[model samples]
Target: MSQTNPMPNSNETPTPMAMMQMISSRWVSQPLYVAAELGMNEAFMGKLVDLEMPVIAGGRERTETEYRPLLGAAGFELTNIVPTQTPLSVIESVPV
Candidate 1:
């Protein structure tokens, strides 16, 4: 015995009612679903290193001001930057 497809043939044109249903459907939901699953503000950073490291490695350090937005994008809020007697500084952040 041969099985039959319930769907209409691909070569056949949809009826006006079917076309209207397609137009009225929520097409934006698919994109919104994907965007929610993968955060819109997700951050990716690479190849950036501190200036104290060798230039042969080929990367540079970013300032505290620059890090604020990056942290926020990754779902954390930058609270403060504390500078010590040494060249290094401490960064504090908490989840939003």
Candidate 2:
């Protein structure tokens, strides 16, 4: 009897780093979207805070100041981080 399926054409195996990059890329995307939606990218400019802000309006209690730095670093490995000692910010928000 003959097998209906044969081995894959490529004799080479994918690199561990490459596979990790692919998986990490997909996982990181959601945080970027959330950060953009939350406007953490703008944090570098001024005192922007919603220390009591929810992930969404009428949603769970969340702090943008705390989470923003974390999200940015997690997904992109940010070159800089705002001072952790700075209290929650409340600068005039530019409408998003």
Candidate 3:
């Protein structure tokens, strides 16, 4: 006689990385949905150049000199960074 099992095999369980990816995908999309609903998408329509301002993470201000190397290491060209009136603040021109 043969017995049948109702439970799924252990191989069907999701791995840690797969679970994280699922969560991260949802987390990233929520902001994009909000931005579209707030008319941000329409405002940027037909704009050839867009400016990206540096974010102050953890309430700490980072100077351009300090962030340049880090951005360079991340494969971004540092020569594209433009200085603004505010100290330690830089804006980058991104082509849309």
Q: How close to the true structure is residue 89 of candidate 3, measured as C-alpha lDDT?
A: 32
| Candidate structures ordered by lDDT, highest first | 1, 3, 2
Candidate 3 residue runs with Cα over 4 Å from true position? 1-58, 83-88, 93-96
Q: Pick the candidate with the highest TM-score.
A: 1
Worst 10 residues of 2 by lDDT: 87-96
- Distance from true location, Cα of 83 in model 3, Å: 4.2
Give per-residue CA lDDT, model 3, range 1-96, as digits (tens): 342332236467655444334334443232211111234353464231223232223234466687666555433444555544323234452111
By the lDDT metric, which is better: model 2 or model 3? 3
TM-scores, all models, native as reference: 0.38, 0.20, 0.29
Best by lDDT: 1
Give candidate 1 regions above 4 Å deviation.
1-58
lDDT of 1 by residue, 1-96 (tens): 342332358787766445423333422122111111222222221222243334412244677777888677655577877775444456766555
TM value for model 1 = 0.38
Tens digits of per-residue lDDT for model 2, 32-89: 2212234445565232345333432233333556555544443433333333334432
As a whole number from 0 to 100, the lDDT of residue 31 in candidate 1 is 17
